[model samples]
Target: MKTTIPVAVAFVAGVVLVVSFFFDEGTWVGGISQEFKIWMTIVGGFTILLGAVSITRVNWSAVQRKKEGWPYKLLTLISIFVMAIPSVLPNTWSPLFGRDVGSIYDWLFTYLDSPMMATMFATLAFYIASAAYRAFRARTAESTVLLVTATVVMLWRVPMGEAFLNMFPGDIPNWLNTYVMNGANLAVQRGIIIGAALGAASMSLRIILGIERTYMGKG
Candidate 1:
């Protein structure tokens, strides 16, 4: 029953979404997918409250104990609530806080959160390059092929990279990214998405079957 339930939902939802994308002629199928997404969004919101409560409880306990950085913890809790409350309001007109609370949230996401996330992601380029360099020695024929592919794709990715090499006689970089590189990346992306969908469906099956008792109350 557990496996069958998830398989059913996955089969129905996946087919409907795929059909909606391809057909685009009917409002009914699209509406169903949109409603499912909204339901999932609500579930995500409630799950977030679990994490927020855990954080607040730890910070409040620290403050009660007179920990050295207890004031900072309190400030963190204040910031979380300040940002979250407005976003959760049923409508923009709700009396959550100041009239422009939504604007404040948007500003934080644009200027503060976005730049921080970008910086973190940018740092990964260096780490990936270093790891590839160490791990991609051309000791074997297969290794040589892998190394060449990785190097060519990496260098062709940027303008300066294309300019740095005087040896490329033709439009090698442009051709690679336009043809080979893009094809490989797109294939990998599609595979990842399919895998993720399957994983989510399997987890949903566990939850619906009561096998995932982690969400249930203490027995």
Candidate 2:
């Protein structure tokens, strides 16, 4: 009975949203559907709160037990409260500490968060280069094509590549990078996106029909 009610509500809401998208704005159903979307946003915020509670519960248990990595877990819990408290303060109160943008929050985000994000991406670039080097070997015709295409694309992107290619009469590398990459890459990307959308739609339909009862803790 519990699962049945939620499934019915989800099905009806899904139908309403699909109809609202295809119907004219002047229709009353469309307007009500838009209001329903706002409620969905509010529900999404609650989900974030739920996630925070879940994380805190797990980490606090670890801290209580003094488990391995307990110190890091404690730091994470402390950081969460430190970041959240000032963020929720009213603008009037914020001015006393300085504007949220100019406060400790901003300083932490700028110095701490920005550097951490930058370091992560910088690390990723080396990993990507290593993976590409291993994968782009010319062992097969397909791999050779991919390797050559990647080499041309990389070359045209930098000054040295362009300078070396400039000694040739024609701008073949530039043309291949611009036209071949743009045209073929765009088509492949679009196909993948459309396939993903269709897959999501199919899964959503199954959920709405209750054929996929996984969400309700059933088969």
Candidate 3:
């Protein structure tokens, strides 16, 4: 009964949303679809709350057990509360309480979180360079072509590299931008997007018809 109810709701909601796309906004189907979207947003908010609760429980359990790396788990719990508690408080209580520009949450996110994220990505650049070196080895004709194309593209991005390209006979940088980036890259991206859209539609149809029970935690 529990599984049947959820599947029925999913089928009805999916059909309504798909059908509503063909109708005018003022029509009953469209209105119902809009309401359903609002309900979806509300459900999304609850899901976020549930996720927070789940994280708290897991970290707290680890801390209580005095597990290896429990100190990091304890820090995680402290950081979560330090960021979240002030953000949820009424701004009327104190200027720094809510998520406004000068508030605790805003300041921490901008100064602390943003810098850490930037530093992490900067550190990752070395790993990316290592991976690129391994990937660009010209073992075959296709790989040789890839290595040359990548070298040209990377060279085109910087001032010294652009100057080096300009040392050549014709407009090499312009040709790379026009052909490699705009022509080939755009075509490949479009093909990938179209394939992904078709796959998503197929999956949605299967779910709507109840043929996909994997989402219901079943094979």
Highest lDDT among the candidates is held by which one? 3
How would you encode candidate 1's per-residue C-alpha lDDT over 67-139 as one tens digit per residue? 9998899888888877777665555465443435456566666677789899999999999889876876999
Model 2 has a clash total of: 0
The lDDT of each candidate is 0.74, 0.85, 0.95
* Model 2 lDDT at residue 167: 81
The TM-scores, one per candidate, come to 0.55, 0.89, 0.95
Model 1, residue 123: C-alpha shift (Å): 3.6
Candidate order by decreasing TM-score: 3, 2, 1
Superposed model 3: Cα runs more than 4 Å off: none
Q: Write the per-residue lDDT of candidate 2 for residues 11-100, one digit (tens) a residue.
A: 998889988898887899889898889999999999999998998999999999999999999999998877767766765765524336
The TM-score, computed over Cα atoms with residue i paired to residue i, of candidate 2 is 0.89
RMSD of each: 6.4, 2.1, 1.3
Q: Number of backbone collisions per candidate, in order?
A: 0, 0, 0
Question: Least accurate stretch of 10 residues (summed lDDT) in model 2?
Answer: 91-100
Clashing pairs in 2: none
True-structure lDDT of candidate 1: 0.74
